[model samples]
Target: MAYKSRIVQIFIFIITNFFLLLIIDSASSQNILTIESRSDPATPEDCSNRWIHIRNLPSRFNLDLLTNCSDYPLFDDFCPYLANHGLGQKTHIRSRSWYRTDPLLLELIFHRRILEYPCLTDDPDVANAVFLPYYAAIDSLRYLYGPDVNSSFQHGMDLFQFLRSDEPGIWERNMGHDHFLVMARPAWDFSQPLNNDPPVWGTSFLELPEFYNITALVPEGRPWPLQEHAVPYPTSFHPQNLTYFEAWIQRVKRSRRTSLMLFAGGGGIGSAPNIRRSIRNECENGTIKNNISSSSSFNIVQRNGVYSKLCHIVDCSNGICEHDPIRYMKPMLQATFCLQPPGDTPTRRSTFDAITAGCIPVFFEELSAKTQYGWHLPADKFAEFSVFIPKEEVVFKGLRILDVLMGIPRSEVRRMRQSIVELIPRVMYRRHGSSLELRSKKDAFDIAIDGALQTIKDKLGDTLEH
Candidate 1:
């Protein structure tokens, strides 16, 4: 009887230990699951796992342009704009992210950003896209002023040959379909005809058949989209982080707007459109036609008095506005609508500047904003944030621009302004050395990269299906 009792006691001890082990194992698994849940969340739309392989092009393609920056005729001293990895000189104000940025340095800015991209792979075989850090804009500037039009084609041709000979495997993989480069100038600058008498205004770099398959990201793209796609023009304000970005948005929202309209560009210049000259004429002469109602037919309204009360005009005829942000940005910040007329190109950098200031841009041409920046700005939702008046109606039909603006209902104005405020981040370029926290908020650079990658992916998918 004693032996049987001892056996039962041992059996009970073994059963209890087994049950304890089972509970411990189950608790460990639950803890692991909790940790995993905290670490991994749903993937963000802006975030990508696609790998980019940055091409190791010869120095002449990129760095050489910076070394000889002073020789560029466009700027008196172009070297200063080459600082901070193409961010230009810092404003030097404490806690302020303002820079004297050159609008044509997008190539340098993009190169720096891609160098620090998280998904960059050294192996071309594993890369989903190839990034060519070629300073095409700066390179073309040298040829713009020279009498030799044929020389414009040399640099681009050399770049093509180098890629074909050095990286034949990568270049031939998709026939350059997976590769991309940023050209800060307008697409037309690179698409000059080879058969012009006095040498056309731009280079023949983009007209090359070898480059037809390669994607070109430009500040101003062609009217009909092809290999060229539009990207945002660089603005002065580049927030350091998400905190600064959000703060600026709130400040713009809370600030009181005293003026109804603002125009910060040139008027009397030879290149200025008649519509721009007319707007300037109206603003400077303080012409306000009170007899005309919003419902009035498109008839000429005689110039009157006190137009300056509603519209603030910064005559950028002296070219001060481009170098001095305070001259134009302040007016834009204080105005409800910023007039964006077609400048040298169908688009102007001022459109982006207004967007950054949280000022609702009023475009006079469809190519200025609607069709140009579809990658950055929503094409279908233009009405929510912007106002468009056909240049033809304003120039030909004698439509009163001021009266039309004043007629927008206050509620609609508020909603439009609010929409513009929300769009601030989409049009901006974050400062270099931005934290991963800041990068999580997709800015212009991120959007451009994502668009380029998606283009390549779609093309590759189509090829595979065929």
Candidate 2:
């Protein structure tokens, strides 16, 4: 009895010490660097030997841009976008709303994450990649919508001036090939051609010769890839920890699926109708039956004065969606397949949101899912998890989307749902809530950073040792 008691006491001591060591180690790491605005400029020695060196561009590049949120008349429309960060002031948490239609929040969230990333170093010397945290999409929103071409061009112009300056000496560092930028908008928005054609919507920042080598991380990349890499758009479901993610996955797996398929978007119209037009027609024609019904007309005019139709959006005319995030997610959870037609661009964040809800996505365009998320999603598992019916077959040939989805076996659908559930962790970003201190093995941010590093290594061809 004495011997056993002593052994138990020793075991307790060792366990307690192990946790104590962990706490001390965590404290030491926190003390290593403070993630805040700094005045010090990055030197050659600071970047020469780091894995990732974030350029300490003036606050104007990020926060200052958001400082004039009041200037925009639709400032109240930005509550959800600014809830996580202080868009201007820390507003009250009125409701659990996830009306993230405008992807400007993606850049804001990413900026917060990279600052807190463990790989982030104060020194620039040992860096394999340089991150230029610029909120180009957010800044140009007003100009893109208005007739202020010079105002829209001003943000890009300022970025160019800073990049070309001798202060940071970023020009000499790998000729900007190793440098990367993240824009929440589609690639086309930044690369509007300066030809004799009618003016484009977005800033022509990307068309500049100086930016040719820079890696662009965007929500939608063009088919013929230059440097633009498609990253997942910000979805409403930001789990605070792995437990919430795992619980949601289990809930989705066991939940009763009463619907065969669901489409949570509005109808479209016009001469050059997108795939959504066919989807709306099919739904109205009783070809596709939605478990939950919504009705509206969202007219979205694209660049060059073309009318693009959109729907399934909660009324944003009042600046905010009245519905809760769960309302958007419930249909997806109850359905076997979620219809994912392009929205404004070829890719929508709904594709990722469907994956999170454990629903198999039926993509109209291959680039919507197949080519976009190469970093986190496995190429081989595309067929195993998703369904792709080309837009031509749907719109031109009058292909029946419901017939194709119903043809897929129940067992196959179950397998695909399980596959999607398994991908929940990799695709979702962890929220900086209570579990911010508790680390995840890896998440979307880590996957993107690792992908960026590997891509640089491949392109540089042995120049980078990291």
Candidate 3:
């Protein structure tokens, strides 16, 4: 009788736990939103109605510059800096960061993707938009980091000469208004220098008159600019297919976020007053300790430009500071929020990584999210997904990072995390060397291409008419 009673109790406990897990899974699934790929059928009409890519441009200006030009192989000389169609060296087979794409290599990725696009045409007569397909970023990098900084301007000059001398009629076509160029770096890198301003380290690609009419799809577009469109900075998170992306979303959504927030970068010097340093200082000052218990996991990494020291003052693991994608993402996945201070410029690629990890980003500057309306993020949805505190208040003033974050209600934080998880696909670069063949699955590259084509159609109006 006693043995039978014990068996019955065990069965009941198993049934109760199983039902509870099902309920939890169902709740999480409710929050997971999948972006449906558009059902637009592929046809000759689709191809002809889309953008026309220019085939006459010098190969040296783009592909050869990436292939033969060997400058930035600090990791491995054999592996080209512009490998895997500008997605960089594949770092992992399962993770998109396996390729380890350089942040400034988006131009190479964009050019290749555009060439492989289903809408690409052999003739320009039946096209809506013209893509220049220039690797100006790579060319600039070769010169910028080289011994002669002034030589960077020559690449821009050479490109201008090619456009004027060889393709004069191409410029006359819509006066270059229907054309566009994709850049991997920030717009400031290629800005035209002012008369008395300190020397900046980029080519005057934006200053050239021929390029004035062209739309620039840059990682960081200047605010209040109409011609420049902000694209996602290349992040470490890359999903191979729809399955990988969906799996990641489900996994991150279900992660146990024990930490209030994390700061994964080093201190800054200019623009904003080293906000990361301020946050680190505040954490040490017992401000956060007074709010959360001593058992909390507030992991902070003291990173110099090269080496990083994981100051595991709390009960954090060694995996917190590992450079590998899984280890790097682990902390983010476990945190409620990720600190995103401006690095060199106002924008950081980690901002997108935070979104990809389903962690709400705490940004210091407005331009970090505000200027990026054209490609990845929606204009009006900033407040719904992220937390923004002005730099002056956070850094200059003695405001505590923990106090500000801990003040948000748990329900609101959950809502924000769900919103961020929904946005993962928008900011991720598709796995490189994947099938270019037509498929229903659409990734970040496909979305950007679609958006660009639509913008061109809207701008050209009757020009694309039959």
Candidate 4:
């Protein structure tokens, strides 16, 4: 009886020890999971792999420029654009998606969005890229319109000197190859030559050797690719959330496009004079040879029908389109094709606006859209959404813009319009403080940042291999 009791006690002791081990193991696993959950919460989907470190630039570079916004240009009021963190004044539109946005305020918009970026790291050691929050466009504005040509390069020179002296470690790390800045102005605005005989119109900021490796995000990039990249110019529509964005997309998709083509800009504005002038002359005269068919080749009438007006002109010659969204947006929403000729630069902000309204953009220059916005509009799919008519063909050959548009089949037009509708989200700049609930969707700013990071990554990788 004593031996039997001893065996039973031993078995009980063994069972209790085994159960305790299992319990301890389970508790350890729970603790580990808790630590992991606290350490690695969900980040924005687009920022999962990339982290950016925004350099702490001096106030003179950005804030001071905004404080003196009214003093820069005598004719234009920039204070309105400086409002809403560079989103410009909000319009009275019911949806609250549209603003009287100025295209030159992209630096403000980009800076605001990046502040809310999810993967921003305080540690520069771990950052995938660095952003210099210098408002290059605003800085240039001070000297661009001033009389002293030699002082044009002063601000940029001071900026680089400050970067080298104060943030030497960051500047020396890859020699600014991973650093990027946003310039709302065109690339030419900063590329003025110092040795020009009569002193050119722009500043010498881009010509500085310090700017060689830095990537410049501009509205219009140079024709021969360097470090300059073209980003979408800000349009009036800045949706606050995914729901509003989708609603606008649906509205544009369902719009009844009554007019065949639309031109909503002023003529006699840019270096390329003939293109816009020709368009204006053609639109005003309202006469084109009926070249749609061989039977009616000689008849001077609108091609589509006998008495119907095929082209719609908003006539922004009075300069009302710049501040008023209703003037241009309405015509674009009602037209099948929006004409995008070269504006003050090779590109125009109206191109993106037309896309927002789900109107197919008709380009007159290769640099206007094809070469400029490759980051937002894919090169392989350019034909899927836009139409291209060479400026030479239109200026020299007397090509009928209406006949070319009328030749496209109705089915093809519908397909192209649908493609443009799908691209609305990509070309738009989402409101600065909007929620990231729709993590799957990335906007124009998101695309630009991602592209910058990826390009830096590739360049760094190549350096390592070589």
lDDT of 2 at 267: 41
lDDT of 1 by residue, 384-465 (tens): 9999988788777887678788778889999999899878878899986675577778889989988999988887887789
Q: Which lDDT values do the candidates have, in the order given?
A: 0.76, 0.64, 0.64, 0.77
- Residue 197's C-alpha lDDT in candidate 4? 61
Tens-digit lDDT track of model 4 for 177-278: 888999998999888886776667788877888888888899988899788889999998888767887788888978878777898887744555488877
TM-score of each: 0.84, 0.77, 0.77, 0.85
Candidate 3 Cα outliers beyond 4 Å, as residue runs: 1-41, 47-49, 67-69, 72-81, 92-97, 194-199, 268-273, 289-324, 432-441, 458-466
Q: Which ten contiguous residues of candidate 2 have the minimum total lDDT?
A: 296-305
The alpha-carbon lDDT assigned to residue 7 of candidate 3 equals: 60
In model 3, what is the error at residue 273, expressed in angstroms?
Answer: 4.8
Off by over 4 Å in 1: 1-49, 269-273, 286-308
Model 4 per-residue lDDT at 54: 81
- The local lDDT score (0 to 100) that residue 369 gets in candidate 4 is 88
Error of 1 at 2 (Å): 99
Of the candidates numbered 2 and 4, which has the greater TM-score value? 4
Task: Choose the strongest candidate by TM-score.
Answer: 4
The 10-residue segment of model 4 with minimum total lDDT is 30-39
TM-score of 2: 0.77
Clashing pairs in 1: none
